[model samples]
Target: MNQVWLRVAQLEDADAIAQLVNRAFQVERFFIEGDRINPGAVRELLRKGKFLLAEQSGALAGCVYLEPHGDRCYLGLLSVDPGRQRSGLGTLLMGAAEEDCRAAGARGIDLQIVSLRTELPGYYRRLGYEENGTAPFPASAQPKQPCYFIRMSKELG
Candidate 1:
């Protein structure tokens, strides 16, 4: 594997980020019926938050979204190429997100995962996040099965 490089996403990266995000989120097809995001949505997100992209060999390997809200930062859309799922790219992106939040004077980070993805809580847990609460999944999503959001948080040192 080539050395993975990290950078802040730019508006011009919308299409690539959208494509990479959809490809990485294909696993959600079991529950969700469409792409996790489109370029337009990514563009909108860019206006509110920043995405940290991980590239390997000139291709996007992973990305994570970070949005600072005063003392807490919201983290989301953590995606890693399916082929690179266990390669530590996700962890690397997460660390980058945390560092960025910490640098911004955030006291903690918050994120949410689909409850149906039972494996996700543990993944975030390993990174020092704890289940803080839950939220109703959007009705518009029309998931194949019942699901909700599991909110998690990690306080920065």
Candidate 2:
């Protein structure tokens, strides 16, 4: 496999990021309404956070969004191209996000996974994130049924 490169995303990457996210999240069809993200929403998020993109041979392979808040950073929309899933790209993106957050003075990182995605909590746990609590799903999420977000966090060393 070719080396995967990482870079900070610019506004121009919003569309490609949105498409990658939506494609990666198509599995949500079992639980949520609509796509994972749209270009306009990604643009809005870009204003408040930074996106780290993973590329292989100059093609977008995956991405994650990081938003700093006080002592912690919020990580979300972790997307890996369906073709690249399980190839360790997601893990690489996560490590890079944590490093960036720590460099920015954050002591921890937090993320919310939809409760219905039963496999996610365990996956995150293996990545060192602990289940902190649950919160109502964001209104913008448009869940297909009653759903909540399982809040998870990991402390940075």
- Measured by TM-score, the strongest candidate is 1
Model 2 clash pairs? none
Q: What TM-score would candidate 1 get against the native?
A: 0.97
lDDT of each: 0.94, 0.93
lDDT of 2 by residue, 13-117 (tens): 999999999999999998786787899999999999999999998899999999998889999999999998988999899999999999999999999998889
Compared with the true structure, model 2 gives a TM-score of 0.95
- Name the regions of candidate 1 deviating beyond 4 angstroms: none
What are the C-alpha RMSDs, in order, of all predicted structures? 0.8, 1.3
Model 2 stretches astray by more than 4 angstroms: 139-142
Cα error of candidate 2 at position 67, Å? 0.3
State in Å the error of residue 111, model 2: 0.4
